[model samples]
Target chain A: MKTYKCYCIDLDGTVYRGKEPINETVQFVHHLQQQGKEPFFVTNNASQTPDQVLSKLSGFGIEAKRSHIMTSAMAAAKYIAYHYPGKDVSMIGERGLHDALLENGVNIVSSSKEVFVMGIDREITYEKLAQACLDIRQGATFISTNSDRAFPNERGLMPGNGAFTALIQNSTGIEPIFIGKPQGHMLEMIRLEHQYEKEDMVMIGDNYDTDIMAGINFGIDTIHVNTGVTSTEEALLKSVRPTGTFETLVECI
Target chain B: MKTYKCYCIDLDGTVYRGKEPINETVQFVHHLQQQGKEPFFVTNNASQTPDQVLSKLSGFGIEAKRSHIMTSAMAAAKYIAYHYPGKDVSMIGERGLHDALLENGVNIVSSSKEVFVMGIDREITYEKLAQACLDIRQGATFISTNSDRAFPNERGLMPGNGAFTALIQNSTGIEPIFIGKPQGHMLEMIRLEHQYEKEDMVMIGDNYDTDIMAGINFGIDTIHVNTGVTSTEEALLKSVRPTGTFETLVECI
Candidate 1:
């Protein structure tokens, strides 16, 4: 098997499922760290800050570097900063997205018709949604973090950011630019920051749609593990197959 | 012009546009009432009660009978009462829907796996939406009051009940049964309640998609007025034309 310089791994369903970590993936990460290689943790969860994510990973017995964390919120903020700098942005999101925008030096306004970004707002309201529609109607550049329709919770699968995005899109007849997996924005951010060639980096994840597709879209090798959304058999059935598919990351070791 | 026994008039675009009443439409209603025909006011607005709609009409100097008002909320409540009797309904909506459900003797529960109904909720919260998704995922029959993507307010067009319905539908992958204009539920309820023949009824409105489509779907006569969403030229271009296309209700009067 070919060794990659940069291993971009997914968090949920790859490293850990809810609070429980996949032991094989954790062992695989440990092995990579022992070899002096720091793998990047890529996630579509834009609700939690890098520190929160690091803490969650620590609880799973996997010590992940803070700088190596690449959340969709961080990517969305960086994307706005690089693309539409100095523009006041109206947003409907939580702390992670707010902190990321501030960290990226993006101006956060109460309401803006210039640029609008959305993340998973657990504290969402109709007024916020109405304001978003008004802004979009006034020709705001609509942007969303990810497009996961339903995310699993303690109770069951709950509505995700994509569902809210769909609402806005349906109302305004305007599509938004999603800066998450399967779009290559996050991967591109990691590549641009670390100056790693596409060939030298590989995406390892359990989901075929977001994780593997993100790698494929970014022109990198993708390894699919059957610990999450998509099974190895399902991954193999896709027309554009991942570089490798395994029962678990244990096979990779 | 062939006179209809039952003239089902739309509210927002036909009778009035926002707070201002269309003088011609108001005069047309007077003409109908003078001829001893009590025209029914059909509205897809699920937020306002019948009394509120009546008060609005009364303010415009059009003496509307309380019994002659048919709202989407009332129709939804009636539909639930008739079809899913004794089943608990989980809902995400406002006071109008709440009152209607109670009036129709339909039990509204906080959480239900049997049925779920949604309307335009201005006080929308993420938990409400999340709960709706969970209920739907748990095999609840999803229902919505209307399918208006956006509605005009002081601040341009705001997201409507349809937009919220789209969110839940996207999240749970369950299509909701929309009981509003363009669906014929309101028209059907009027027919059932008044015992009016389809030929004796005429749906008059400015919108071709909702009002005219509802009439056509219900197998009744429809009049297209060039006063709202659909223009006379646009209405003429549709494959299925209305029974009567006029500049305004004054033409029929």
Candidate 2:
């Protein structure tokens, strides 16, 4: 059992996509655990809840504890509460945004009242757009859960909250205060969660722009997997090349 | 009937979405033709062909001659052919990129043999990514339709090719030779299409980051539509404001 201080991994395109999980990935996680290593799954996709992700993973025979998962939405929630006076107004999104708002004790609103925080909302209408427009017109501050527009899935890329934010912005002159990765808060969340010094950590993922670059931006080591959008050869040739590169996390060990 | 030498219009939020159309938008075109303006439907979405867009618009009850459509994809393809030579490449997009490549007379390949082009493919995959990486490593060049991460829509923002491009770039260190708006070819397309001796021909669209700014970059007049991404008030408030700002094209008339 090789004991490592911390282990962070991306969810989609790495561990699983939709209802399916890479069984080899599950065994690798078990292998990591058996080796006395702690594993945590981090995801940029803001649509699903940690419970949902965990359940999906469990279906693939990988048991992910509630604490074993961290999401951009939850990190965003904590960031909002820490920065704002009390989350006076939030335009809001799906369960992730709601969960964050409630956890941070921030208030979510519909009309032109308080702060208008926007995120991924599967349920949307012109009614919500009208309300958000009114809120922005009235000078309520604007915020967004993340700037990711389309999230990748088995079916392909689907619209995320960045599109909704664009919708509200199109109706109002406001741009959101973004606190997701690349702009930095998720890294801080990772730090706060594990108390691991930045020197002790290495960010690993498939996407270079979001995952590897995000780690590099935060001054952390990155290991890019040629597993997602980029091919193995391309993954090997980044401007800010990863400290380690592999076809999969399984290969990293 | 009012007569004009040239006619140019907007796309995406302006016309068909999925399989639906906004009310009265198509009717406006009929009125435009009644006025005897040479019709040209200009678009920022570089995904579809003229026939495809025309067909989509026709399904939505707005039929246009294929020649009446001006797509950024076509513009990009022409730009590439005219500028760079002897580089036949592999592309991973819909009919739009395919048509663009063929029209430009560039030899298109989907395999590793002398592959020189990689166009935007929203319907991306690991196999495509691998092929692109292989060709790239073998010195194949890259081109993209557009860099937009997502298209703002009635439903929400759908992931555009830029997200896919980033995936490629992350993997390959090969930033594309971009040919869409606000970068290389769109301005040329605008100038060539409008044929206005007066540069005062205004480019109107809902996307501020691309459309308005691209017009500005091209030294053309632009009208910011609040229906897209940048609101009217915000568009006006910017230090570099649009020539005109409207809630919708209906208001401009």
For DockQ, the strongest prediction is: 1
Full-model lDDT for every candidate: 0.94, 0.66
The residue-level lDDT of candidate 2 at A55 comes to 80
Q: RMSD, each candidate, Å?
A: 0.9, 10.6
Q: Lowest lDDT 10-mer window, candidate 2 chain B?
A: B1-10
- What does DockQ come to for candidate 2? 0.04
Summarize candidate 1's per-residue lDDT along A1-253 as a digit string, tens digits.
Answer: 7899999999999998888889999999999999999999999999999999999999988898898999999999999999999999999999999999999999999899899999999999889999999999998899999999999979999999999999999999999999999889999999999999999999999889999999999999999999999988899999999999888887887
Best by TM-score: 1
Clashes of 1: 0
- Candidate 1 ranges beyond 4 A from true positions: none
Please tell me the TM-score of chain B in candidate 1 relative to the true structure's chain B: 0.99
Question: What would the C-alpha RMSD of candidate 1 be, to one decimal place?
Answer: 0.9
TM-score: model 1 vs. ground truth: 0.99
